[model samples]
Target: MKKSLFTFIILAMVLNAFTACSSKASKGGGAKLKARFEVAGMCSNYTFSVIEGRINPALVEASWTNPQTNKTYWKAFGISNPCNFPSNIKEGDTFYFEIVPAEKDSKCAVCMAFYPTPGKKLNIKVVQ
Candidate 1:
């Protein structure tokens, strides 16, 4: 009886572990969005602007509206350590990407000069 009880407990623990892992994987694991690499200028950190998908408004740190066209641009900074921006993609190239969390100690060096980019940045990875 004790052996059966132990086996049952082990099975339950394993099932629980799998359930937790699956939940974490699906929570923030599937947010691919389409964007174009629009370089604002030399000083801008976020050059990838949304082209075909919507980003969480809360993640938008900076935005610009073109008065003539009435088009709005959204920008987010990409974390470089874990995510290396694709080299083949050039300015104005459209690509798919997903938002990711920046590491606790991650940092990107930049100038203090003002640039037309969202002050808020969301770590993102280029998805094929």
Candidate 2:
């Protein structure tokens, strides 16, 4: 009986150790998520569309090109050039902006959002 009790104690200890290790792993497991992409270059009422979205690496870099009209949409993201704001895109111009995600699918959803800009507000699918 004593031997059996000792074995059980040993088994319990082993189980507890495994459980603790698993808990630690879980605490450090998942990848970091990034913020969704959005632009307010167009009318506050109009919404921008995501042409293509894929994870490149740690940084999410996206540029816009008006497919239908053959124009650049850098200003949509509040940038003028590759590293400039307004993207030199004038107001009321039909532009396309590629929305890139920060982190991968482990966390953030590949979604889009638009903040109201002056007279026009970008359209969003949200109920509210």
Candidate 3:
């Protein structure tokens, strides 16, 4: 009987300690990916599915790479800095640009996605 009571007390203490320590980090309250995408596209209000490849910066110009087309565009779509992905982004403040494909069936030069830049700024270029 005594052992059982002591075990219960120890377990209770451990659980309580864990709960208290776990909450040390304060959550700043961030919007989800869906909300972030929607906010970014307030201009065009575009939304798309997740695709392969990471976000590409708008540094290389002239020829854009798109994952959708697997080809390069003659002219880059112009994506600027401080941009975030169209989907699964943390904050709405992140800026994002799409790689304009050269043709109907081609890859976005920046990302090389089959369908690049659904809900994003039309033209965002890397500053010289």
Model 3 segments beyond 4 Å from truth?
Answer: 26-128
CA shift at 9, candidate 3, in angstroms?
0.3
* lDDT leader: 1
Q: Return model 1's CA RMSD, one decimal.
A: 6.3
Model 1 over residues 21-117: C-alpha lDDT tens digits?
Answer: 6654443346667877765444434455666654555555357653334556665443333235656877778888776666777564656564454
Decreasing TM-score order of the candidates: 1, 2, 3
Which parts of model 1 have CA positions greater than 4 angstroms off?
Answer: 1-29, 65-83, 105-114
lDDT for each candidate structure:
0.60, 0.35, 0.34
Model 3 Cα RMSD, Å? 15.5
Residue-level lDDT tens digits of model 3 in 68-98:
4464433233223223233344322333233
- TM per candidate comes to 0.53, 0.25, 0.22
Clashing pairs in 1: 62-118
- Candidate 2 lDDT over residue span 2-49, tens digit each: 999999999999999998766543332222222223434332223232
